[model samples]
Every structure is written in C-alpha cells, then in structure tokens.
Target: MSETSSSVLTRMGAAFGSMPPALWRLLLVLAVFLVGGIAGWIGRGVLAGPADVPTMSVYEDWHLLCPALKTKDGACEISQDVYEQRAGERLARIILAKEKDKSMVMYVTVPLQVLLEPGIGLKLGNDQVRVYQYKTCTEEGCLAVIPVDDQLLASLTKAQDAGIDVAQPNGKAAELPFSMKGYADAYGAFLNNEAKRKSWWRRLWS
Candidate 1:
C-alpha cells in the first residue's frame, strides 16, 4: 500500500485503541443483565406485572415490616402504628376460621412453630392450613415469637406430651370445626370475655 494509505489505517487503529476499556465493559454488563432478565421472565412466566409482593398478616414479626421514620418513602410507619395499637401488654394468637355457623368456630391456640414437626407429632386438623399465629402475653409468661418458616407446628411436633385437643380438619378450612362444637363450648368455660373498644390512636396504628 501507499504511505498515505498506511498512515490513515494506523491512525484509525490508534483511535480505536485509545477508547476507554471501561466503556466496553459497561456495555457488556448491560447486555448480560438484559439477557438474564429476559431469561428469568421466560422461565417464571412473569410478564409486565408488579414486582413487590405484600406479606401475610399471620407472619407476626411486626418489627421487620415496620417502616422507617423521619424519612421519605417510609411505608412501614403505618404498619408500626397499627401493630403497636392492636398488640396487648400480653398477647395470644388464635388459629381459627370465622364462620357464620356458631358451631363451626374451630380454633386452636397457636404455639411456637419450632415445636411442630414429623413423628414428633401434633393433633391439628387435616384441612387446617396455618391461618394465623395470634400473639398472647400475660404479666408473668409469654409464648415464643418467631418469623416466617417458624411457628406452632414446629413445637407441637417435638413434644408428643402435649395437652391440646388435637382434631382433624373436616376437608374444609371453615368446616373443620363442625364436629367439635360442643367440645369447644365446654373446654374454655372461664374466659367468656367481652371485646373492648380501641382508642383512635390504636385505630391509626392498627
């Protein structure tokens, strides 16, 4: 080739070499992320939807869900207020279904999950899904409080020597208590308690 053509080609090569390596790496990273996101969407079949999933009320650790204070974008502040209000000095959670039939009010005292497991054993109903873990506290003693993947099922399974009247679910979340109407009536004969009204502040927190 002629001298001028050789020099022009050399200048073009020099310009390409002078370009920042970081820019190339950044473009490569962007391409990889786009590919990964596409793959995940295809695998999960999640298309153009809200990514944020709300937690269930039954997972009773209110502290983590509580929002930050004195800052922008703090959603948990409302949750914090509500929990502080509903929560009692002593709290107990009831695992039960609400039904129109008075005889169907099947319920159990939610124990710590750590106490539930396999051959360890618990006498809950077959159709009974973990509906709730009601928190209860008295002046002297309290039930163990834990987060997700931990609840009454754990504790009950370990200690076969438990005293709760274990009953099987009657194939429905609501009807599971149908057979035990009279039994439930006679069991807790003492705590015929009246519901108390909560204050405005409690309502706000709640």
Candidate 2:
C-alpha cells in the first residue's frame, strides 16, 4: 500500500485497539439483527418509492423530499447528504421520517465498505450517543435505521450538530458530520405535509 494508505490503516488499528472489549460485545449484540436482515426489510419499506421523479425543497442544510406523483399515502422525508472533505466524495445520507402511528425514524446510509460487526454510532449535540446495527446492504450502501422516541426527537430538534460514526473494513474509524442548521423547520414542514395528506385521505374515505 502507499505510505498514505498505510498510515491511515495504522491509525484505524490504534483506535479500535483502545476500545473496550465490553463495548465491542455490546455493539455486537445491538447489531445481531443484521444476521436476520429484518432492518433491511424495514429500510425498503420506508425508502422504496415509485418510478416517478421526486421533488426536493431545501431548508438550510436539510431537504424536504417528496414523491413526484402525489397520492393520499405518498411518502416524504427530511434528509441531508454528508461528504468526505479531502476527496469530496459523498459519504452518507441521513433521513428522518414519520410513521403512520406518529413515531419518528432516522435512517443513516453509509458506504458498503463499512464494518458491520461494530454497527454504527450516532452522536447528537454533546453527550448523547446511540449505537445502531445495520439493517441491510444494497448496491447503493448499508443502512442503519434508528427509532426516534420523544426524547431523541427533542434532541434532534434542539441539537446544533450531529454526526454518524462507522468503522472501516480495515479497522479505521470515520465520523461523518451533518449540519442541523434547519432541522426544526424542515421537520415541521414534513409534519404539516403529512397531516395534510392524511386529512385529505380521511375526507375521501369518509
């Protein structure tokens, strides 16, 4: 390997070495569902869309994404793309969506080269850290779906910064940071759009 590549790998090994065994075990258990691919199914359900072109609206750093052909049950989400600084390559995409039951979910998609055993880490604001297992892998990348409870939702709305951490196959750790500059406004618009759609559907059925 080139000197630069070798140097990067060395740093990764050192980082992983410093991690406690118990932490590794905890991450492993959290990621156990990866074997069954249940999260993959859920990812598909949440992200899949018809062939029609999608529409996008920007709210500062976040985007309001919706399907082109609108129906009563059309899907929409707030999203942002993270990029690698040096190479300017797209690193990951973060998505936030609300379920029919009003629960929130966040999907983090990273490169296919990610290490699945350790799953991934989510950092919100200063001290909160959440570890999530990989739900599935596709040609695009691997995905981790995080269920957002009320507390987590509040954190996201209030956090000024957020990041996703992943381990590389070579044992290197990478943190992909995404901005929360307009998350609250984007999410509010998402909720309003969802409510309008649901109300229209109910009126039709009624």
TM-score of each: 0.21, 0.66
Candidate maximizing TM-score:
2
lDDT of 2 by residue, 1-206 (tens): 89999999999999988999999898898789675588777786787655446668899989999864445457789999998879999999999886766677998899999899999999999856789999999998999989999889888888988889999989998888889998899888887776756675545533
The stretch of ten residues in a row with the least summed lDDT in candidate 2 is 197-206
User: Positional deviation of 172 in candidate 2, in angstroms?
Assistant: 3.2
All candidates' lDDT scores?
A: 0.33, 0.84
Top-lDDT candidate index: 2
For candidate 1, what is the lDDT? 0.33
Task: Write out the backbone clash pairs for model 2.
Answer: none
